[model samples]
Target: MTTRILIAGGGYVGLYTALRLQRRLRRGEAEVTVVNPENYMVYRPLLPEVASGTLEPRHAVVPLRAVLRGSRFIAGRLTGIDTERKVASVAPTAGPWLELDYDELVIGLGATSKLAPVPGLAETGIGFNSLAEAAHLRDHVLRQLEIASATTDTELRKRALTFVFVGGGYTGVEAIAELQDMAIDVLAGYPELDAGEMRWVLVEAMDRILTTVSRELADRAMTELTGRGIDIRLGTQLESVEEGELRLSDGSKFFADTLVWVAGTRPQTVVGELGLPVDGRGRLVVDQAMRVEGHPGIWAAGDCAGVPDPETGRVSPPTAQHAVRQAEQLGDNLVATLRGEWPRPFRYRSRGEFVTLGKNKAVGEAFGREFDGALAWTLRRGYYATQIPTWNRTIRVLGDWLVGMPFGHDVVNFGSREEPRGAFEEAAGRSRVG
Candidate 1:
């Protein structure tokens, strides 16, 4: 019997690790299979662009079968894992659960937006974690402009025009900056709504935006965003959400139409099912080799696994850079385990961080230097294009950047109308007839 290797969550780690294994292992050596909710691997770096209509939603996601080379693609979401039995619990797109037996397992289950008990937040807010969220935001932002243009009531117009983004990390900053920029451009198409009438606000509990970058870059980014009339609320936290009005900890309330939740993400619950040593954040504890400590034939990487940073003696932060590198090492280790060789430890250092503002504007800290504006923007694109799995994809993405330079962003609005699927009680009061 062939050695079966099961990989869960085909985001960065799942997709890349499977691809690496496919390339290294011989046909009869081991059977490699990937399990994910979707067949495509989203190029998460360009998600901000997708939300802003700078690139098509489909462009950011690569078909797993098309790019994964030679590997079995099981279109399913991993529900749980039995490490001792080497059987993974999986639920297909629309079916009951089944157990997928594996000789070795790679847990790359990824993370979800951390949702707290802020009233009405679960139903009212939109998260920017996946491609669907990006697409939904694009549609919703444009639709808000349409609503603003048609309304005569001052309060209604104000509500429709006000766009609030919570959190100012890379995801939050890039999303609001691009969407705000796109909304301004879209206003040109709607003569009735002056771009100036629209309010773009960024609320950060932290003192600065893009804390991943240098202090200088963060300061400059704040100045630039505020200069563009974006209301920067520092040391502010969201208190509650009721009747489409958001109340902040500062005792200020705004009846806003859009609220973007990019506060943070927590590791998937699959880690908890493993019953291994997990941190408070639900991340699996792994040693330098990316192996679950004291657990044989099982490895975890990406956002789901907590790989410690040797220098700081703390877990490494979840990032695409770390995930991709870890995936490569995980693949090598898994294949080595298949043979007689012992796998090497997984150690990685972050290259840098970058966040794109609007157009050719960006701020980044790379190679121990801070960069801003066009240079940083160019650097960001170049880095992602190279890191992306295939050259075919890189060429296509580079083409997108080139196309955007001359024609500008194409605003495509498609409203969210999909039926919410979950437990009946969860959707009972939440579901609305559109």
Candidate 2:
């Protein structure tokens, strides 16, 4: 008998789960297939460096073809899953809806950028979640310095040099820190532009930044950021961003050309389309075994699924750490189910939280102890290197770091911003043509 398995989303959970599934399942008993919009599993932990031009954009992405040796990999975005029919509709690049049938399904579609509207945000603001965004940010930041140096107009120059970061989680903090470091180095090339003139603001609605870490560390982070002249705004909100106006909750107004929205993410909408049992937050509800409740032969994990934490009695924090662990155990449970054995519950405590700040600076808490500055930075890199699933990636990343230590950033603009714009841009061009 052939048991066909299909896994969705090629992120941390999807890739790792499939890797484990292929290893654990009997040779002829089951055939595993994984589907994802991206053909590669992006090592998202290093995206900050990519945005800052510290790491090549491609360095963080591991191609699925090379990684998933045994399992069949499909490049497609999931449209819907009919649990009753046990069929999945996939929409690949420019093709009819591809149908895939699965005896068992793993929902790991991962989270998406929660782009709640703030007026003019889409056009003017950049996001920090994707490879494209990382590259664009690097180019934009460098270009800003060049523009500022050549331009005599003070307002235009200020607008160009100013950078706004909207969220203050690990992504926002690390991004601001790394980019700030990079900008300082890049500014050395332009004699006219003082690095001090460039403004970096970290905007967060919460009372403090890096709330995931301990309060002591969060306060230290706040002091460090402020000391570096990065304005830390708390209990505030962005009302809108139109033209030059950036309205805020504290009756404050600011103007800048750059706005980086790290506001956070939500699960993919395909989960709702699947008509599976979902939580209020649009995440799939899974048991301790990582199996979807009331659904036969179906399982879900990662940020897209609500896996409860036994210690807290709440859903597990949707971090990369938890996602990988869930996938690992989920694989083991599925293998046990295939063998007609009782599956074990997914139970693990979060080891700690860590955030990187530029080259040799970081802040973290591990095993109830706090580590900051150089030591934390080393631990951060060490932990991720170990966490990365493949030896090939581990070696490549380590080599890159070794070279980057003495030699500074390898910054280059590959020019990805030339995608054709709409009628408005065409109209402007037409007016010029006349």
Candidate 3:
């Protein structure tokens, strides 16, 4: 009998695992089915560029159907799992719940922003995790510029021009830097708005930013950002956000129209509901081979799984590189188990880490060497271009970069795109009255 493999989530792990299985498995070897909320996988590292209009929103995502040709794809969410019966419950986009039986299951249902109990934050602050959020941020920032330029009220203008980011990690730093760069570049078009009036503040509870990188690199990044007029508030916490007012632990009070929250992330809520062995951080417990402990046919990886790192003897840090490597090992292990062969343990050393500051600006360490500025930026782009899966996407990404260097950032605001049906609704109302 052919084995049934079900992979949940279409992020890095899900996509890569399915790709590996499709390539390795022979005809009638095993049936693979993938379930995910979105039909496309967002290239997360390029999200900063997407927010800055350096790359188009569509170009930053890989269409799942286009890439996962061999496996069955279901556009839905994995709601629950029955480990005893080996059945998974899926809720499709426009249908009833589905019960899928699988001989082996892979859980890669990524993470979501971890929100603190800061007052009014849930209602007021926005996250920078998804593609939609990145695109929305671009439009929102442009709208703020328009508001600042047209308004004569001093306080309102100050609020509109002020942008606050809470977090000092990779996402927080990269996002603020890219968006700030874009705003400065487009300031010439807003003749009424002065660049000096814009305030970009990055608040971090920790003493340093980018703890994953070295202190020298972090300090270098800090210097680069501060040189660009961004306020780097170290060891500061966001106390509260009330009615557009921001209170910090450092006894500072401010009112800013835009507040971006990128503090940290936790696994998807459904992961907890799966009744599996998870660590204290709520990540599924998996051995070095990416297999869930006590559950023979169940496997997990990526941000949602506490996959042990052989080199460090600790759970692997949730990063794109680690996730990709883990997925490959998981796929290979699954194949080995089916063939009655012993699976090898997943082992990988850190090649490097790159943090993009802005266009042609980055800091990275590769091959035991530290690099910064344009060289690091180019290396980062080249690495991601090759890792983005399909050649079609690779060409489009490179083309965007080539076009962007000469033409500069696109400043057009398409905030209306969010409400594409508004015009139709208004027309329908008018027709009814007529």
Best by TM-score: 3
After superposing candidate 1 on the true structure, give the runs of residues whose Cα lies further than 4 Å from its correct spot: 416-434
Per-residue CA lDDT of model 2 for 1-434, tens digit only, reads: 78888988899888888888878877887888988888898888889988877666677888898888888988888898777889999998667889999988988988877876788888778888888888888888887777888999988998988899999888899999999988887665678989789999888999988867678888877777787789888988788999977887788887888899997889887787788889999999888888899997999999899998877788988788889999999888888888889988889987888888888877788988988888998898988877776887888777778788887665455454545455678899999999
| lDDT score for residue 163 of model 2 | 90
Worst 10 residues of 1 by lDDT: 416-425
Clashing pairs in 2: none
Superposition error at 71 for model 3 (Å): 0.4
For TM-score, candidate 1 versus 3, the one ahead is 3
On a 0 to 100 scale, what is the lDDT of residue 287 in model 3?
83
Candidate lDDT (C-alpha), each = 0.85, 0.85, 0.93
**Which scores higher on TM-score, 1 or 2?**
2
lDDT assessment of candidate 2: 0.85
TM-scores for all predictions: 0.93, 0.94, 0.98
In what order do the candidates fall by TM-score, top score first? 3, 2, 1
lDDT score at residue 115, model 2, on the 0-100 scale: 75
The 10-residue segment of model 2 with minimum total lDDT is: 411-420
Indicate whether candidate 2 or candidate 3 has the larger lDDT. 3
